[model samples]
Target: MFRLQFDLDRIIGTLEREGWVVIPNALSATITANLRTACLDMWRQGLFHEAATGRASGQACRAEIRADSVLWLDQVAALPAVQAYNAAMDDIMQAVNRGLYLGLVELESHFAVYPEGAFYKKHLDRFRDDDARTLTTVFYLNEGWPQQAGGQIRLYLDADCREFVDVGPEAGTLVLFLADRFWHEVLPARQQRLSVTGWYRRRRSSMPW
Candidate 1:
């Protein structure tokens, strides 16, 4: 088996320098495809409910809350797709050892879809209710995408603490970034865009000042 390896120092160094890092193809094609199918299936089965928010551009999506996914636990936990995603996270966490510096980290997975013309306005992923959110992970689930698709993910780096970087929404692309450092948003989608996103939460015990 080809053991996928990453330069831990480089990963940590980049996180400090750029505030974010991209691990290309962290999941194999086979694994990615399966994950895509499973994610789409979850959406199709009506497992998710539309979220009421100020941002909406004709895209339809159901936010799968991490704390309330009990209705279809078997559908999500038994699938190899979720396993693969978790595994990828394991690999990343193992390499960077972000845990060593941050205490008691947690992740909440949310599946989202934006159909044609759907877009998300500029915003931050961290929850304002609390400062527990630290990092954000966005794993693209689309395949055979084109540049003009317009479903691009723009992630700004300290762009006035509002917006700065634009990450590609291409299939199999994974974006890892600081959740509260800068503002980010998704542009209008020429076609449908699907992705799995979650936050790596940090507690006071780990990120104390």
Candidate 2:
């Protein structure tokens, strides 16, 4: 198992104070390279589908609002590189639960590819029908992304959506934040942007059908 190198205390502290944190070099170069290769392979194979909005039954592709393509990472056994990445996330999840007592029981992730001019509009991650998603995590895989690249993620700081922070899509960088608290958008990209996006979800009792 790959050992996690992040500072757990600092991550938790930042989450408590700012509702989000951007960690540079969060993943090792080797892992990042492997992930990039895997993503590209999947893309070449036409495994990615246009991303959609809304929850479970109501989800539908709305290309006008968001144009990225995504392949859901449901089976870790499909790729050794992805499996290692998932293991590392498991460790982080355990640490987060221990520190914040968020009771995050599971994580779901997808490999996302945003082609030139693709973007997602301002929105929160959690859906109104389900409140399971507690935290959102986005790990970028684009190496040496230039400042001129227009695909930075813009995160609004408050309810009024006035002040914000724009994060570049840098390789090995990870962005974490409360799912329901932040309003964020992806700006149009000058080049292709790649990332593994995930969410930590709290367990909820299922209603009898």
Candidate 3:
């Protein structure tokens, strides 16, 4: 078990100025290795399902819009690797609340596998019916990902969404951004791509059944 240490000042500063940041070596080597193994095991066991778009009643599989498989993370009785990753995320949540005052209450994550030729269309993390999602985080688990692999995440910058940057899915690399502020997409890959994708949400009021 390794202690998680991040440059809080740098992260906050970047978020405040640019609305996003990419951090390399986000996870410790041990944790990253364990998570990669766990993801592979899950993939081999056929635990992942074809990812869908929309929310709740509106959710539907649209392969043309996006093609990938995903397995949502369980909060209770999670595996060791998941627990460690969650703990690290909790630390990040605390720091984010203190720095940005976003009132983030919880995190939800999933293991996503993008097989060769799979890609997701440009979209925002937040849904129309739900505004609780405040921040998006993605940690890559692909080891030795080549520059030519073509699984880069392209993020459109600023309000106009004119400029962009391509981020490779390299192992231990983490990308964080304001959920509604950016429109991003996953480009087609020449090889398999793996990642843990998650979102931090603002607290929601309880609704009566």
Maximum-TM-score candidate = 2
Which candidate leads in lDDT? 2
lDDT, candidate 2, at 41: 93
Instruction: Please write out the lDDT profile of model 2 over residues 1-209, one tens digit for every residue.
Output: 25566788899888988889999988788888999999999999998999999877888999999999999988434798898888888888998898889999988999999999999999999877677899999999999999998899999999999999999999999999999899999999999999999999997646343
Off by over 4 Å in 3: 75-77, 205-209
The regions of model 1 sitting more than 4 angstroms off are 1-8, 52-75, 98-100, 159-163, 204-209
Residue-wise lDDT of candidate 1 within 120-174, one digit each (tens)? 7767776545577777888887887788887777777665745455666767777
The C-alpha lDDT values of all candidates are 0.66, 0.91, 0.90
What pairs collide in candidate 2? none
Task: Please give the distance, in angstroms, between residue 121's alpha carbon in candidate 3 and its true position after superposition.
Answer: 0.4
TM-scores for every candidate against the unseen true structure? 0.78, 0.95, 0.94
Ranking by TM-score: 2, 3, 1
Residue-level lDDT of model 3, residues 1-209, one tens digit each, is 14455687789889988999999888798888988999999999989999999989999999998999999888322799998989988888898899989999999999999999999999999887678899999999998999999999999996677899999999999999999899999999999999999999997545343
- Flag the better candidate by lDDT, 1 or 3: 3
- Cα displacement (Å) at residue 208, model 2: 15
